[model samples]
Target: MNSAVSFFYFLSFLTILSAVMVVVSRNPIHSVLYLILTFFTLSGHYILLNAQFLAAVNIIVYAGAIMVLFLFVIMFLNMKQDQEESKTNLTKIAATIVGGTVFVILFGAYRKTAIEPFNPQTYDSQIGMIESLGHMLFRDYLLPFELASILLLVAMVGAVLLGKREIGERHF
Candidate 1:
């Protein structure tokens, strides 16, 4: 087929492979690295969708900062004792059932979704631009935006509290 379609498939393959590797890798550091690769490939898909802002944010926020934080936690935890415990068969079966149920629910929901065709006349090319995003966040969605920020602040404080060790607590 076309080069763009080929590139899209290649990126999709990369994303899936890295995602699977993230789950399958024995080493936490390697898993984090694979997760980073998955995020990068997802960013490629965003670029293919012409969502440049989303692509950049995915790369910068997910692949960059979040992955670094994950790697740091993985390294700092030194979870050798935890690794000795293998998953029970019941736990694995439960996880599989839950995962399958969620997948079926999402698939059925999306299958019934009515996708509207693209309309050039009503479309705004600048909809995904940073300026438009700023206006939308500050004007139309100000309250939700501020609330999310406050929630993030609370979560950050909680993370800091959990990071420090407490008396009679293991890795708390």
Candidate 2:
């Protein structure tokens, strides 16, 4: 196998492991931290796929900005450590049955799908640098881009409003 394929497999493993950790971790803060690690590993996979611009954006938007917000919220909340609870025998049996059913469904779907192997030669020779991405974003996706900015602005305002403490009722 080529280095690219090996690197892809490594990144896939890292991303999946971290994602599982994010879901299974008891502490909310630890889950968020593991989710950040998963995002970073996904960015590495994007880079390996020659989508450099997407990788950079993923790092900046997910690993850098969003994770900072998540950490800030976690710290502000001052969350306590979670206690482990033992599952009942009946509950464990039901969970195992459900999990096995889902796994079998997914395995059957995978087997039914026709997956073509990757061909490196099919990759476009043009570089997906920031400049090229910017050009495409401006030319093709300008409206959606501006809408996303507006959506983010609204979310920021909502977060501030929700976090603000009300002292007294306002009089006209």
* Per-model root-mean-square deviation over C-alphas: 3.9, 4.9
Candidate 2, run of 10 with poorest lDDT: 79-88
Considering only N, C-alpha and C atoms within 3 Å, which residue pairs clash in candidate 1?
Answer: none
lDDT comparing candidate 2 with the true structure? 0.88
What is the Cα-based lDDT of residue 159 in candidate 2? 94
How high is each candidate's TM-score?
Answer: 0.79, 0.65
Candidate 1, 1-172: lDDT as tens digits: 9998999999999999999999888788899999999988998898787778888999989988988999999999887746756688988999999989999999999999999999999888777777888899999999999999999999999999988777887752
Q: Which regions of candidate 2 fall more than 4 Å away from where they truly are?
A: 76-78, 81-122, 156-172
Q: Which lDDT tens digits does candidate 2 get at residues 1-172? A: 9998998898899999999999799888999999999999998987886788889889999889999999999889876665434567888899999989999999999999998786779855455777777888899999999999999999999999998778895655
Candidate 1 local lDDT, residue 90: 87
Name the lDDT value of residue 108 in candidate 2.
98
Global CA lDDT computed for model 1? 0.89
